[model samples]
Target: MNNRTGCEDPYLNYVISRRPFGWNFTDPPVFLPFDFEKVDPFYWVSLMETNWKVAFYAAAVYIFVIFGLQNYMKSRPPFELRKLLFIWNLSLGIFSVIGFVRYVPGFLFVLNQPNGFYKSICVKDGMDVPTGFWTLLFAFSKFWELGDTILIVLRKRRLVLIQYYHHVVTMIVVWIVGPLVEPIARWYTVLNFFVHSLMYPYFSLRAIGIRVPVFIANLITFLQLSQMIIGFTVNMTSLYHQQIGNDCVRYPISIQAFSLVYGSFIFLFGKLFYDSVIKSGRRRTEKKLL
Candidate 1:
């Protein structure tokens, strides 16, 4: 599994062993047709690490597009893109579910190894297989997810500061840090995939005029709020580990960005849940007493 040098199998670089189901098999799961390192586009992982201006420019464009669409739709009636919206959200929901299934197993497998979670994140290895490929796809998907703002703008829905804040900051941070497969990132990605797997499909059903219980909707918001709180805690722990030189590897910038971003989500989503669910529930209870 690992050598005395504190490294893992050179070819299966992140695993102690894929025993049980994969006991006889020698290789890790392969999702891509070719090795990710051999792929040309993956070179951007290192390139973007150095050329961060590209990420900034992409963020700028996303911001401009969202605001531009909102302004353009000011005088226009809200487009009834309900069918299209259902399709969009459904697609995202399906994608999130698939990501959950594919990545979570590999993620847990790595974690199950002896000190594997730390080693997987802290070290870079050529043989880490499909996890790298999925991470790239997940990062790339953020660019397209900017369309979520566009949809809101077209539908003439009120875009709060939280909405813009969540979208823009996520795009920037995810793009910049996506290549860094720090162990904390596994938690972030899995949380997102799990949340979206439920949230998006719920919204998609609503888009199609299918009414679900209000509690289901409330649960989604609650899950989001919980994720921010938990994620913040985990991130802080990671930073502490890094500070003590506990073999944790992460970009200083990534940790800093997450601090601000996750911190905002905690407050914003907390307020939203209180306003939309908790307060409203209290009002209904008071009215019933009358």
Candidate 2:
């Protein structure tokens, strides 16, 4: 082994991350933070093996909280909340970019081919790289995203079914799937970078009071669904191919959990898309006929 990295451990934040950011991913293993004492030792891992149970529990909790809050907000007049929501979403968006930008160059230049040789040759090339930073960033971003709920709550916005469910399930999913780790983490990050590159700007536009065209909204949803479809297929294939198990890296069980969530979300959200927009048009047409 090389004598030393001549630098501190890349995961110093794991043990000592402070707030506004957090100590979330500084964890027992992988790139996640160590000893997130709020949950049990295997809380993250249990989310994978018992996903449906956990997912439903999460969904139920959010539904109750969101709807309860919505009813409470009904008594109050609408407060001007755009600025706060905008800043919150924008901050998360920027954090996503920071995490994405930090990793892309290395993924492209070093791991372009993405077979066994890429890992080997990339390491030997003496790149000024941190081995596990992407995983760390991806892991860290989940904690940052908890702010999504804060905005909805503080701004007294109506927490719709989809938004509430998305927030809660994603919080649980990232905890379970460990989306930022080795093997699968690379592809997940790349795909997320691509997705968020589009997703965030859409938020930014709407935040600034620009109306996103209906077609644009539909296209964005389609792209998101497509991302999940591709991710599930590719990850399953990678899971199978890597069964040869020559240490080319692997996703751990958490990736599989995320794949299942992606599959479920695509199905649920696809239906949601049809129900919300297509049915709205159908209902309008039927009313016109009557």
Candidate 3:
């Protein structure tokens, strides 16, 4: 009955402990804000914690909508499957590489002085530690990701359970952690930018018409797998070092949920990719030889 079995459910623990500071959730003439100082960080993350129900409907709704539209449109030019598919895969591929690449400079920024982010980028600073415009831009990117699912639906593409779940959940989780974990967010962002850079380009290419070199897709998957692996490794290492009374970066929650969510996603998708790519390729070669 417990969401946690140990004291080490990082995200659960950190999010539960978060208290609010003064910040606006949305701005403009109707600047809706929260008294960050008055609210508990726990409440904020809990409230925004990826709404799976909404996300589920969000994931499925589009598929059906497209199905109906396709049906009604009669001979609707067959959905232009080629170009759209290229863009989709191209985006995912480029995003992966770009995200990783972006992490490089930020890596140096911390290397010169260093905090735990050097090891893992999921660490957070207190609420006011704004690194400025670019940081906020990264924070807001979470919103843009909602459009990703839309792209899937519009193109009438198959939605893998893991892909659908991963995209939606990650978008929400990252947003939740973005503000909460600021210390090494730059590392995570740059890594993500690198990933996105590669990811988007891959998707674009897939959309336009090109079978992505299998290696590129494999590389993206490998990179993602590494991210999660590193995430888990760093969390436990930090946890261990902290236990030993050493001064480790104290952002456990980011890693906790990260390990849980991303770990599962990486494993699931990795297996999926391996099965579809490697195994299938092997089988095809074997069949040809026979």
Candidate 4:
């Protein structure tokens, strides 16, 4: 299929033809690193296809560094790099907002058309467009987000298992599935971008000593849990399509892996909400009554 024009699939052609207001569908914006008009987006696709295994290597190194830093910090004073953490979260938050803008219009445009729902789940065209460029960056950004853990460790904060596990699994899964260019990836990318746009900025505010309300934090966790639930639903839809002999372009193994990861997230986040919010509220209420 021609990734540039998406001429082979009529639906994809339709999607590419209509440029929504404020959306960059063809070329990378000036702010982005590469000039997509000069460089084929497939060049990066080829790199991802070939070097996907490198995510595993990077994850291994990340694990080593985080654990080693944790042990080293046990005997020393924690360095409070408040300014740096603020910058980091703000940067990622901005990037996520950009990604959300780049990805969502096309997704909504596709979903509103006839048979659009199925096509959104199965069609894989327009890889040389702006969506493709941002998708590549989205995958790579997983690695950059690992820095959040490093910041936590340096601050002598308690690093929970869910935190690092989520980072590592997310990095690995995005790397492995990105080159496949599955249609379902649109949902994953869009929802994640939307969540992070709120999440990272909230963290940035806290980093700078801003007193955000408790409810806002709860809302963030709620959005994250919703994202996970939707992710599991998308994977299940893929599996159902495959079972019915539809032409969904996802591997069975990848679908299974995604299901497991998302399912685990549902449980982990639910526990977190219960422990931090519900139980804590009950405790405060009981103390008030006493």
* TM-score on alpha carbons, each prediction: 0.82, 0.63, 0.62, 0.86
* Residue-level error in angstroms, candidate 4, position 268: 1.4
Instruction: Identify the candidate with maximal TM-score.
Output: 4
Candidates 3 and 4, the one with greater lDDT? 4
What is the alpha-carbon lDDT of model 4 when measured against the actual structure?
A: 0.80
- Model 2 C-alpha lDDT versus the unseen true structure: 0.55
Candidate 4's TM-score reads 0.86
Per-residue lDDT of model 2, residues 22-133, tens digit only: 1122122222323322232233333444553554565576567656766777778765678776776677677667656665554564454346334522122212222234
lDDT of 1: 0.72
Candidate 4 residue-wise lDDT, 1-290, digit = tens: 22225456453355445532112242322132334422344567678889999999999999999999999999999999999999999999999998888777667766775777787777653233556667778889999999999999999999998899999999998888777777788889999999999999999999999999998998898898899999999899888988999887788768978998899999998888888778887998999999
Candidate 2's C-alpha runs over 4 A off are 1-67, 114-131, 153-158, 177-180, 242-252, 272-290
Worst 10 residues of 2 by lDDT: 19-28
Cα lDDT tens digits, model 1, 137-174, are: 67777777778878999999998888778877887888
Provide the RMSD of all predictions against the true structure, rounded to 1 decimal: 5.7, 8.8, 11.0, 5.6
lDDT of 4 at 149: 95
TM-score for candidate 1, please give it. 0.82
Name every residue pair that clashes in candidate 2: 25-32, 25-33, 26-33, 26-34, 27-32, 27-33, 27-34, 135-180
lDDT of candidate 4 at residue 106, scale 0 to 100: 67
lDDT winner among the candidates?
4
Model 2: what TM-score? Answer: 0.63
Backbone Cα, N, C clashes tallied per candidate: 0, 8, 66, 0
Q: Relative to the true structure, how large is the alpha-carbon lDDT of every model? A: 0.72, 0.55, 0.52, 0.80
